[model samples]
Target: MREANHFNERRTAQAAAFLLHRSGGQLPLIKLMKLLYLAERKSLELYGVPITGDKLVSMPNGPVLSKTYDHMNGAAMSEPGGWDSWISDRAEHMVALLDPSMIRTPEQDLLQLSDSDLEMLQSVWIDFGHWDRWQLVKYTHDKLPEWEDPQGSSQAITYEKLFQVFGFGKEQTDALIERISAQAYLAKV
Candidate 1:
């Protein structure tokens, strides 16, 4: 299985904020994580890119956006920059938007998203947003090939493995990988 690029915290934070805004400033933590995963997965399928660039991990529950999950649960050692400026409380298995004013519009938080990205996110929301946490979990476990019984251990889901599951042509996978690699490189420079 081919590894994907490293997690991008800034992008993850942006995605979190966008979801919070979309949900009207509050979402159950598990539901938020599931939505993020579904949106990223959809983005990958449609555009060969994930919305947040976060690492994807396979857990017993399903596939999760690892770094973003950590942020949502306050597990990260240091919160991603700008995270505290907007997302305020993570309590009772829920994450709440601290400041609605922090973002003038969802577009502001979603600067990285292209028109296609927005469309995919919308599609994901339309399809999955109403499902409660458990329903989302069932859908993911049933649908995503990346999911495996981690047996209580988190397993990394590499893009290389995912490409095989998605049945994408080699050339398409190569182009996606190349673009992702370039973006990762550029983020560091």
Candidate 2:
């Protein structure tokens, strides 16, 4: 799968909302971020596509959706496709869906994801949503082979390293990354 090579605000918000709604309309910021990262990584591993086209990074806590992290910290609220409308700003290190009740049905929430996309989010919730934020942080940093300790700083986690961990050899990984990148480029045109 290819990275969107950029953040997709609408899809990111929708995914976050879906997760937050499933988690009872609120989640600790770190927990929410870990869930999204796991979901994105799972999507790429399973279908060669990501749920959100956001950059991934290894922070001191764990891996996260880079731009989505920014939004959680109250960035880009006024920008198109941002989470401002769907999610409440972080308060006491937690965030909630702005109108969790508004997500009436699975069909109506289709802001940008397909059935497969929705399914992936649910799967992530089932697998890791129950973990407390600290549990998630430990799992990501200790269990996930892709994340490196960034110490007191952050570092980019590339698809290349993840693919390797997923058992893709160099050539195969390069080709897959190239194809995904071309798709991302064409989508921009």
Candidate 3:
């Protein structure tokens, strides 16, 4: 299992790298904006953070800004002169604001994590999307016990961990939970 996880991580990293290279070392402004939007939305969902109207404003000149931020005050933030830098900064800021403890290396908490807890977390990530969530689950699972029950109630833990990792707020988390529950129920039918 560990080997498989390592392989998956390596593959994911490689895929991300390839994606970067394919885009000439810079994702287009449109793609970056999309990612930013997803990050913000996920953050809001998992962490209970309200998506401020201001956060929706794109960096200046980004595609879709006219439609998304037409009524904003100042110009969109500058594009940082480089795609990687701009995206990285946006991601870091969005994640940090959504869950400061998650992104803050020295302030993280894992004292209550168990093996089953880790598995459930991985499941959540697989259910959600990929990249950040998957990486965070793998990291937590690797460091926690694997002997504990994997079927325990995990609502709070799942919510907290996801908020920590993905910066998703309460509304986002609730919606996701509802969506996942509905999907699971439908699958049984």
Best by lDDT: 2
- After superposition on all C-alphas, the RMSD of every candidate to the true structure, in Å, is 1.9, 2.2, 18.7
**Candidate 3 residue-wise lDDT at 93:** 19
- Which tens-of-lDDT digit does each residue in 17-130 have in candidate 1? 777777888889888888888888888876788777878899888989887777777777544464565677698888887787777876665675567767766777778777
Q: After superposition, how far is residue 77 of candidate 2 from its true place, in Å?
A: 4.8
Off by over 4 Å in 2: 1-4
Q: Which sections of candidate 1 miss by over 4 Å? A: 78-81
Best by TM-score: 2
User: Each candidate's TM vs. the true structure?
Assistant: 0.89, 0.92, 0.24
Determine the backbone clash count of candidate 3.
Answer: 15
Higher-TM-score candidate of 1 and 2 = 2
lDDT of each: 0.78, 0.83, 0.31
Arrange candidates by TM-score, descending: 2, 1, 3
lDDT of 2 by residue, 147-170 (tens): 888998988888887888899888
lDDT of 3 by residue, 35-150 (tens): 33343333334443322111232232221113222212123343322122212333321311112222222113321222333333334334433344334334334532221223
| Residue 131, candidate 3: alpha-carbon lDDT | 46
